[model samples]
Target: KMSKEKIDLLKLMGANVILTRSDVSRGHPDYYLDMAERLSQQRGLFYTNQFANNANIEAHYRTTGPELWQQTEGRINAFVCGVGTGGTLTGVGRYLKEQSPDIEMVLADPEGSLLADKVNGLSAKLPGSWLVEGIGEDFVPDNCDLSIADHAFTVSDQDAFMYTQALFSRELILAGTSTGVLLTAALRYCQQQTEPKVVVTLACDTGYRYLSKAFNHQWLERHHLTGDLEGL
Candidate 1:
């Protein structure tokens, strides 16, 4: 983790600061950049290159897409992903489209996100509040190519959380919030197609990071999302 002392030193040395908050945690690169720009202007300084380029984020997404294609023997016809900083969705979507022009890139946005509206050629509105993290957006990112997405699904936070728990209990693959959205979208897409089509969705991150938030029953009950775990 980055330390506050180092951050303060960097700021003292004229480094443009980009402070990320929970409000933009599930938003896109454009949202973070715009926030940074506003802060910089208020402080009478220029803030450029305000984008997330974490190696961990890039590596995971890049690896997942290629692994899926290889495991499915290039038969994957559709992919569903949730957009966070547009890294995973943009990188994987671009790669899959380049390999197969007809492949459908589906975006799984939270119910109140602007992404679904933007992809469907509708005017985007300010997003409503949601419990899900690391997916959905109040604004779109510059790197995200809406044209590459053939369809979009607006999933609810409750469904996303419930299915995420199901994934852990059934498949033993503990995935985070964004993955829940993707899985829900992927199932929906698969059921709609009559033909035998291989579809892929990401397990964006491990559920360990969300234990305190999503996996805890106490937290769920606090949010009025309590349910039977036996079926999960």
Candidate 2:
């Protein structure tokens, strides 16, 4: 689900906003992606099927991957990220591997997502629900190249929210729920390493967009996140 602020901001930018069911699976008629496709067809509008779009992968591969390589001076040992449509994973992962095959491509997945298990070579499991939005998927999108993932980690909503809060309080960096999952996985990967290494993870979006969810104390309490904040 998207945050209220984001939805409002989109409307403020003059984009027509449409609400869809958050409870539906990918194949369901009410699923956001399916609904978007149906609406686009009915209205004779061009639909950007990001999940299967080569342009999505190519943009990240040509721009984001090269930028990271240049900014880091080619010393990066790992690239950590969450998979939404899979563009970033496949594109960046492919680019990084081409530059250096030793660079690790790490996957940070939400607790309820099947992506982590899929990376670990496990059989498909029924998808579960999570509080975090955008990153995790019930079904793996074609754009995502899971083969690039050398390691994977699953993060709970409690851990994601708590660490995201800490990122702001301690480091003064405002990040989103999905960023929390990436941060958690990156930290774990760093901690388990035997030697010093360069690691990279995404901030994704700002916390200002999630003020009513991850940044709300009352909402955190209601979701049982209050207790786990200290544990993290």
Candidate 3:
């Protein structure tokens, strides 16, 4: 896990990194709570569960919400985003809803994720996997308030990766794969709108971290992404 090795390096710099079992899909949020409980019983574990933590949400409420409000001059008609920890959406959604309850908060979900189903009140399907990292879930995190989302869009892996590459070429922004999913959904939301509206989504991470996967042609081919995109 070269990506997580960065967290290990942080440990060397006195950042306490608690090693947990690999929970790939976020299918069961309980696994993390159980892990925390088990570890707490064994040792002096200070579990800062960011998933349900108010502080995590408040940080964005205070910082991101105000900044977006000011930057957009309060003309933000819509906010779309993918969920990793659910903090950003929860915080920003809370703030925006407070400002104007009429504002749209749309959830940009990966096709394989059950979250969109949850938000839309559809029956859950068998969970699947996607190439986009740091978003999509098999189970809703505690911080995910689906009421915030006026609508949801389920993006395919191909669509997500295609938009990711497009961002690199079109905007010169090497955005992460999850950001692509969000942006794709956001664009779709924009197109479907009846009136002129200001829609916003975020570039969640740098694409430099994904150079060996999403940015690699061989990896794309292996995953059948480029082929799928060509068909699209």
Top candidate, metric lDDT: 2
- What clash pairs does model 2 have? none
Q: Report the C-alpha lDDT of model 3 over 1-232, residue by residue, as the tens digit.
A: 2344346558779976665544443434445556675666666667777778888888989999888888999999999998777888889999998999989999999988888888888987987766677888767778877778789999998889898988888779997888989989999998898889999899998887788778889988888888434343
Per-model TM-score, in order, reads 0.74, 0.96, 0.85
Off by over 4 Å in 1: 1-66, 228-232
Residue-wise lDDT of candidate 1 within 125-195, one digit each (tens)? 67786777767766666556577789999898787888889889899998887788888888888889998
| Number of the top-ranking candidate, with TM-score as the measure | 2
- Shift in Å, residue 136, candidate 1: 1.4
Residues 103-170, candidate 2, lDDT per residue (tens digit)?
99999999999999999988888889899987999988989989999999999998898899988888
C-alpha RMSD by candidate, in order? 6.3, 1.3, 3.2
lDDT of 2 at 115: 97
Clashing pairs in 1: none
lDDT of candidate model 3 versus the reference: 0.81
Off by over 4 Å in 3: 1-33, 227-232
Tell me the lDDT of model 2 at 149.
Answer: 96
Error at 175, model 3, angstroms: 1.3
Higher-scoring candidate on lDDT, 2 or 3: 2
State in Å the error of residue 218, model 1: 1.6
